[model samples]
Target: MTVRRPAHEPAEPLEERLRKLEKINRALMGRVERSTDFSGNGFSLFQTAIVLEGQVSARTSDLKRTLEDLSDAYARLEDARDDAEEAKQNLTSAIEAVSEGFALFNDAEELVMCNTPFRALLPDIETRLAPGTPFPRIAEFFSQSRHLVLDQHRSPEAWRAARIDLFRKPHAAFIQKLSQDRWIQVSNKKTDTGATVVFQTDITDIVRAERLRRERELDEQSKILQATLDHLPQGICMFASDLRLKAWNHRFIDLLSLPLRLVTPLASFERIWEWAGKSVFVHDGAGVAAVSGWLRAPSADLDSIELGKSDGSILSVSGNVMPDGGIVVSFADVTEERRASAALREAKETLEQRVEERTAELTREVIERRAIEVELIKARDTAEELTKSKTRFLAAASHDVLQPLNAARIFLSLLGGTGLDLRQQHFAGKVDKAFGSVEEVLGTLLDISRYDSGSVEANIVPLSVAEILTTLAAEFQPLADQKQLRLRCMPSGLYGLSDARLLRQIIQNLVSNAVRYTTRGGVLVGARRRGGMISVEVWDTGPGIPADKRDFIFEEFRRLNQDVPDTPKGAGLGLAIVRRIARLLDHPIAVRSVIGRGSCFSIELPLCAPPRRVEHKASAERLPVDLASFTAIVIENDLAILEGMMELLQERGMRAIPAVSIGEALETLQSLEKTPDLIIADYHLDQGTGTDAIAAIRRAAGHAIPAIAVTADQTAKVQAEIRKDHIAYLRKPIKTGDLFALIRKVIAE
Candidate 1:
């Protein structure tokens, strides 16, 4: 039996066929047969086939559902592929963005991928990295040599540490030759799959900064050590165990004055020791073992020592042991302090010697002073004895001397009144002249006594210099003529206020000295202008004073070139009187002389002019003197002077009257016994002065009297007082001629 079936049968549909196969697979078996049979018989199979065709039509619907499941699975597989591609791109970008160079390598040390930075390290290499390129082969192409990757465990120890490869290990360290050399840091890492990653960063600036920092720190430490050593006062040095100098400060160099080659080296100590001495060797620690004597014991150390230099300078030295088996020594010079101490000791010794000598001299001086005291007492006793002797002599002689002088003056006057022959008259004139000279001597002695005893006082007045000179010349002309010396005067019409009598004395003494000393040339009286003053000078061509003795001549009792030794003349009180008077008048006196030629004595005095007029009272007791006849009215308080004046007036052919007071004179004028021709009054009247008496007489008579005043006190103030009455003044011991001449002038006026 043969059988066949339809191709499109329901029982044999493709979907159903696959499902049946799947079902047979699910059944337990090692393997399963695939078939489209439900029953075993071929005819049954044929019959089902026709039925299966119809079922195939229904299975065709299942084909669409199976297509939708396949499309969903394909969509999920596409998404997984896209995610993997994006992750690969992100890894590439991250590698490029990092600053350090980067690369990846395989297990055999072959480059897989390299970034731009790593490519830049090798400009000649291909920009894109690929597999299976030997790392050393590529490195040699760029770096011109094998750039090995480090494998410390497999490589030789020294070479392993130094391994660096620019291509395989992108971060490998490298050197760059710039202005200066520079360094770079490199790092590498590997995954479990044996792929490597490399990183690199340039570190040249940091390395340079570190090197500079180290150098600066070293330099700073060296400077600080050197500066500290230089400031030390003592010499400092270090010696090695081999006895070589290892270090030294500036002070040690300067102390030896060593050369620069010697200064910065260890040999300087030996050179200094050669120039200075073995004394420079400090000798305990720094010195040779021979000098220290410590060679036998290795533990022996330093000792202190002092040495004096050849220049007599002392040095103090000390030594110490160092930890490195060397020695250090120091020295100080102390010469100046020693010298100062020596000088101070010497000074103290000298002072002690001086004190002893001064003490001895002072003792001798005390003994000498006692001797001088004894001599002084004896001299004082002798002076007292001499003073008593002088007092007795003056008392005994004063009365005898004055009585004889009075009698002689009276006799001379009486003889003049009588008629006399020419010879007798000539003898009478000689006697009068001799008596006048004697009176001058007595008066000068009296003046000296009065001046010395402080009894004389100045009577200052204003007077004309012309008048003083005229009066002096009138008194001294005869003496000047007898001596044949011209006594000349320069007219000084100037006036001054001074004691007129004292001024006259000063001038008279100077003039007398001039006349006595002068022989041929004239004596000149003149005045020179001083500041606010007039300096009156008496100059003569006389024996000038010797320069040696000129100052001595003005002293009391000094005489010069005296020829008339027995005359009892000047008594040498003249210049002394002049000096005293100049002092009294507050005038300055000076003398100048030339030996054997002349002398000049000058007196400086303040200048004053006379007043315009002097007022006076009128006298009425006397009539005016007759024009032809000489008449006189004599007023004398003493009867002797009154009678003497009366007799002298009558002899001169002038009528005279005597009244003692102003009232008596008025009564006498009223009686009209005789109207006096000229009035003469003694300055001292009984009731009032002659000046008042004269005024009374003039009032009664109704006219001024041509009166003359007579007084023995010849002081300038007394003369001025009398002259204030507008009358003629005369000094007592009156001369007959002056009396007659004054009366004649009044009558003539």
Candidate 2:
């Protein structure tokens, strides 16, 4: 009857089933004893027990399925929690990577999170700014530690209150200056959860740049104002409201005769006024009071006051007041104008008196006027005679003055020919330079005399312009080379009707002027056709003439003030002489100039056809013949000149015969065994003229001997006389080069 129970069944359920079976058996026995019915009831009870067993197995299966479902749901919930934690960590790392300081606060104003820079911004209270820290407490900590530097005018408590007020309701971003002179821009934004995020950025460099830009603008304005004041014509001085000098110009110092040290900026006006009173203004008793009253006036339109000094100087001073309570004063020197006005008033009064007196004596004056007229005429004639006498004296004394200079020049030339040391040569060169200066002065005087006396005559003939320009270029080439300037002469196949010698002189002077004034570039000589005449122009790259001064430059003793370095100033007579010579030759001279560019001087001469053939003279090269093989006869009025000539000739290894008169020259030539090869005679002899002496010498020699006429007279008549005799002429003081070249040429012919 022991049936096997299922191995998987619960022990408690099985035991309870066994106990219930025993109880049912006992209840069946009792029922059997009590009542013997066992039919339909027994069958119904057996079916009910079977149905209960099936229901128990179904309930056990349902409980097991419910337990498995609960375990799977628990695993899904744990995975979701892990994903949420990783998302939170990523958000924090992103916020910490920002360069700017960052902080977050909850709605209750308690600190939620903060980056390292946020805490570093307030290093003293870095721990206090941790999580859960109240915003008000953080502000209190900053205020106590002096971490935030408010405006200098605000107290810490007031600033903290204001900052808290702003924190409660932030409008926009604001900049705060921190301790140690650092600057920060702070911005606040609200998150979706009602928390606040604060961003801080350093802006010190931007602030510094703004300050520098303002400083540069101020400096530029100051420079412009200073330049404007300096360039003003009038003497200007500015004073501050306190009557201290702020600025002044050099003209102000010069006008007031103020000391240089007293003219500095920030100088007190009182010191300047005292200096002016002592040095510039007349120190009368009332001068000090008057000046003080004028300076201290509140706002007055000051009339120009003329101040007089003990040294006969007058200054006009005017004052003006600015809207800012500052003062400006102007000074002008008016001494000359005042004196002129006084003189004119006195003259006018004197003239009125004289007119009244003359009216009363008109009849008496009429009778005496004829006699006065005659006397005036005689005085005029006497003046004319004196002028003529002066001209004659100058012309006559030119030879006497130049004789010794000529002899000295020849002696110096011979001395230069001899070898010498460097120091000796330098001294000799200095002497030569002295002689050159003397020659220039003498030549100028002689030319002026000759032009004034109407002695220069123009022999107008067909002449080659190229020939003259070429000669000039050759003469001035050395000078141009020394100055490092290019000299160009264009070849012109054209001819002009002009005097060859006078034309040469005019062109030479112009070229010399061009070379002297030009600092760079070059000088060009060329000709251009104008109407029926040819204009020969000399162009130079030099400081040009002002339009106002163009006509004045041709006047006597007129020169432009051109401050070129290392260039020697001339006597200012070159243009004057050129004008005179141009008029004498009937050639028109014109000048065109620009102020800073250059100038062109041109002369118009009537154009003519060139000759069939032009024969140019031989160049002035040294001769091949020995000078000692020739005999030279010299005639002069002065013994010293005659002896000097002999000495100079003997030095040159030439045979020289000296004589003072025509008779002496003839006697000396007759004593010579052979005909004289050359004869040098002075224009004015002791007894007869040099022309007469040359004639006598030629007659005695019985041949037409070559001769030279040396003279200081540059008149056309003297030149004509020498040329008429077919003799060469050299001007005095004679150039050694010319003398030797002429002698060599004559001997060679």
Candidate 3:
């Protein structure tokens, strides 16, 4: 082989051989193209080598390598076909295992293959190998857009490398939307038989998962927004453009005690706002207007409102544009803080007013207290001065007047026993009557002194009013006769327990006043019975008491008359003495009068038990005297009084024995030899009192005789002395009737 013939064969290397084969292939291709026709000839070399002979050798030695190459290519194609079948089976099994349906269709738009799941997706189909089943038949079974692409014409490599994408057409996710509920993927390609390969994938769960993801994201964002609104201090709300409330928080609803309708669909926030604004007219309309003015705010500028709630609460409102173009409002209640501030201001004002008022009241009280203190001091000083003046007057009156009065009475009694003729007796009686008047005036002054000094203690005793009246009649009748005024005493025998001396003074004063004031008309002294009491009245028919002057007539030192013309006068003390005695006896005194009419002065005495019968009889015995057969001796030191006594005795049917001195009385008694039945001694009897004369007369007669000490001494000491001697004492200005009564009593005993 290594000969020359092998050397020629070595001329063609591996690269040269490949070139030769390519050349031969071209030649053969050209020959076949030229010689044969594809139109039913069936004798083309290319077809013959490829299909029938399977030979078109380029070189004898390269033939085996080419055959081997053809074999390996065939083996790979067989393996790929087997792998495609296995993959189809696995895909079918997987689709059946899934919950959804799946289907496969051929390029002819017919059902070629389908899994059990796909059959389930069909309405009533059993197998997938049905003929003439259109590829669009499954469109109704699927819920979304399905695509069928014929990929059977594509080589496997091309199919894998080809760009593919899937998308579900726009459709409603709900089955009621008349869209396919299930989905598939169909791929078609150009092949020898013009068929297609199709795959159907049910994508309903994927569609649902995508929708759930979107919903979860939306829910989370909404929760975030709601949480932010809730955490805000102010209440938030949304309202329609028509002013109807859509939603609200708790705070906005509770602020006004208002019905929900006001801010709800029934009424509206717009109408409620108008009403609330008008109600705020009291606190200045700015607040209400500001709240109501929010309607015109721009979207960027939030509306703000200051609201005053009906429950004394204040609210701040803010509103803004919502994403959906609705009104969103916020409110906060500030009631407690506002109330606290108002209360603080009010308390301050009240405190200031109280301070001012208290200061004014204190000033007024201080001034009033000072004025009262000064007035009290002045009153005290005036009282002291008045007390001193009264003491001096009382002392001077008793000493200067009473001493001369006592001596003159004694001289008058002494002179009465030594009387001569009627002319001499008459002259002596005139002097005695003049002196008697002076003594009577002195006794009245003593009574007034006792009353003013509060020293007149009452000696309450039971006595007969009748007897008292009778005695007063006898005492006052002569005075009444002299004044030409009738003195009538009508007595009621009413017994009363009272101060006897005071009672007598009251009656005497009443009678004396009647005589003094009366010009012509009569005076009356009487008693009448009342309920549990006796009213003793003194009535005068003279110049009647004036109505204006009646009230003050009984007051001390008060005189009803400014002028009087009577010769015998009073010191305006008679009625005053009556009032004082009435008070001392606890008797109520009253007067009734009319201008120019008569006046009546009355005393109401309370009734009490009668005294012993003996005391009553003694009082009665001293009433009126019968001077028909009585005889009395007149003894006085003064000539006038001695003569007056002798005339008075002679007039009373008594023998006259006038003595100018006590010695003359002794001579008369000795000469008479009968020791005259009674001795009439004067207190001023020629330097001896009537009491001294009584003792001297008994000494001269050498026997004790019934005698009377007649004097004007009204002092307690004088009265006590006279009582101690067991002699009757009579005060002067002694009337004829009183004198006769004393004489009769002394002689009868």
* Most accurate candidate by TM-score: 2
Per-prediction TM-score to the true structure, in the order listed: 0.39, 0.50, 0.36
Instruction: Name the TM-score of candidate 1.
Output: 0.39
lDDT of 2 at 671: 78
RMSD of 3: 63.7
Report the backbone clash tally of model 3: 58
Q: Which stretches of candidate 3 lie over 4 Å from their true place?
A: 1-400, 406-437, 474-488, 519-521, 555-569, 611-713, 716-718, 730-748
In model 3, the Cα lDDT at residue 331 comes to 75
Model 3, residue 199: displacement in angstroms? Answer: 99
- Give the alpha carbon lDDT tens digit for every residue of 89-189 in model 2: 88789888988999899999998988888888878888788799888887788787767877668887887787687777744477787888787888887
User: TM-score of predicted model 3?
Assistant: 0.36
Model 3 local distance difference test score: 0.60
**How good is model 2 by TM-score?**
0.50
lDDT of each: 0.61, 0.76, 0.60
Output the better candidate (1/2) by TM-score: 2
lDDT of 1 by residue, 255-304 (tens): 64556565554564455555555433333333343324432222433344
